[model samples]
Target: MIEVENLTLRFGGLVAVNDLSLVVRPRTIHALIGPNGAGKSTTFNCISRLYRPTSGRIRVLGRDVSGLRPQDLAPLGVARTFQNLELFGGLSVLENVLIGAHVHCGGGLRERLAARPPAVIGHVEHLLERVGLAEFRHAQASALDFGRQKMLELARALAIRPRILLLDEPAAGLRNREIGALDRLLNELVERDGLTVLLVEHVMQLVMAISHRVTVMNFGARIAEGTPAEVRRDPLVVEAYLGQEAAHA
Candidate 1:
């Protein structure tokens, strides 16, 4: 569903992503794993149009999106969560998600709310429920705990009804139980909802347990790409990212 061909990005003298290439198949969980400074987030920024590549191409659902603006992505069935929380701290949980739904609901927010109240409100409520935030809908986003805040961001992304989801470190700062919940939710999204996922994560347990394919990166380039088991056995992946103990585990 997503393809990166010979993608390169340079920040002055430093090269963040160096001719990296990978493909994420439809309705599957494809993971991008690497150590710090591996350019995983930079590659995401390029795909999401937050950063223009120095060279190469990015295609989403068969269209070249290299030149598209970040706002343009949501309308084309794309939505992403940041590696860090990007929540509107001052907004209510429900209100934050409603903003994401604006892509689907055209016209001014007041007008849409007045005309198609049921559809818009129902959809946002459903998304909140899906992410276990139904009870917190009226709460301020900044008032929620860390894990709940993460889930709220996921809900907001889902409000766009994206076919492809790019999640950067969704497992970071989450408790084991919350991680388990995230695992189930992600599987449900792909299996039942037919969503495609491109995940960049450092949480090995979550990545290994859930991903259908894994691409390992080091020094801003791909070193290995395979099934989780195959990647675990790859010498380059072990040496660069997973290490000997992790490879054995």
Candidate 2:
């Protein structure tokens, strides 16, 4: 569903990402894993047009997305959550997720501000239920637990109704149980909803178990790309991922 070719990004003396390329298939989960500063997130920013690459190409469903804006990317089938949760602490949980549907709101800022009417309230309620947050719809965003907060982020991204999901470390701060629940939820989206997911996560278990394909990177370059099992067995993957000095050190 997505293809990136020879993507390169540089900031003055540092090359954040170099000659990176990969593909993600429809209705499948693909993972990009590496140590910190490995350029996984930089590549994501390029695809989202949050960062302009120095060179190369990015295509979403055969459409070139190299020049698109955050707003333009959404309706062309792109949505993402941040590594650090970006929620409106002052808004109610329902309000935060409802903002995701901004692209579909079909109205300007004035209309949204006036959506306090009963009609708007009803639609917002349904979106909350879709993310399993109906009971906390009116609760303050700051009151939610970490796990629920992560789910809220996903819900907000999904509110855009994206075909391709770019989940940036969705499991980063969660416990094992929360990660497991996330695993199941992502699979459901892939299986039942036909969503295509490209996730960058550090949790080994979730990355190893849930991904159909895995791409390993080091120092801003592609090192390996294959099925999860194949990648795990690759010597370079093992060297970079398992060798402490190569990855964590």
Candidate 3:
């Protein structure tokens, strides 16, 4: 559903991402992983259009994305969550998620001020329910635990009704139970909803347990890309990222 060709990015004279390319297929979890400074986040920014590539072509269904803007892509069914939570602590859970619906809302300021836009209220409720946050819909964002905050972020992204989801470290900093919940939710989405996922994560346990394919990077270059078992058994991956200690695991 998403394709990258000869992707490269530079900051000043240094290349942050070097000739990277990959394809994410529908209803599959395609993971991008690497050591720190491997340009994982930079690659995401390029896909999300937060940073234009210094050189390369990115396409969604053969449509060039190099010239497309973030607002332009939002309506095209691309949704993403940050590595760090970006929720507004002051807003209610429901209100924060409503912000993700911006791309679907074309009303002017007056229309929003008067609450006269089309009825997406049902859509909002449905997203809240999907993320298991319906009971906490009216709660303050700050009141929820870190796990729920992550789920809230997930709900916010789902509010866009995306065909593809870019999730950056959804398992980061979560307790085992929370990670388990995320694992369950992801599988449910893939199996029931048929959503495609592009995940950038460092947690091998979680990625190995779930992802069908794993792409490993080192020093801004893709060193290995293959099925989970293939990636796990790769000598370069164990030597560079997982280490011999983890190789035994």
> Local distance difference test, per candidate?
0.93, 0.85, 0.86
Residue 35 lDDT (model 3): 95
Q: What value does the lDDT take at residue 75 in candidate 2?
A: 82
Pairs of residues at least 3 apart in sequence or in different chains that clash in candidate 2 = none
| Residue pairs with backbone overlap in model 3 | none
Off by over 4 Å in 3: 108-119
Compare candidates 2 and 3 on TM-score and give the better one.
3
Q: Write the per-residue lDDT of candidate 3 for residues 50-104, one digit (tens) a residue.
A: 9999999999756899988876777888899999999989888887777777666
Q: Write the per-residue lDDT of candidate 1 for residues 60-130, one digit (tens) a residue.
A: 99999967899999999999999999998998898888877887677776644444467878999999988
| Model 2 alpha-carbon drift over 4 Å, by segment | 108-110, 116-127, 243-249
Query: Using Cα atoms with residue i matched to residue i, what is each candidate's TM-score against the true structure?
Result: 0.96, 0.91, 0.93
Better of 1 and 2 by TM-score: 1
Pairwise lDDT winner, candidates 1 and 2: 1
Regions of candidate 1 where Cα sits further than 4 Å from its true position: 107-116
Best candidate according to TM-score: 1
- Note the clash tally of each candidate: 0, 0, 0
Worst 10 residues of 3 by lDDT: 109-118
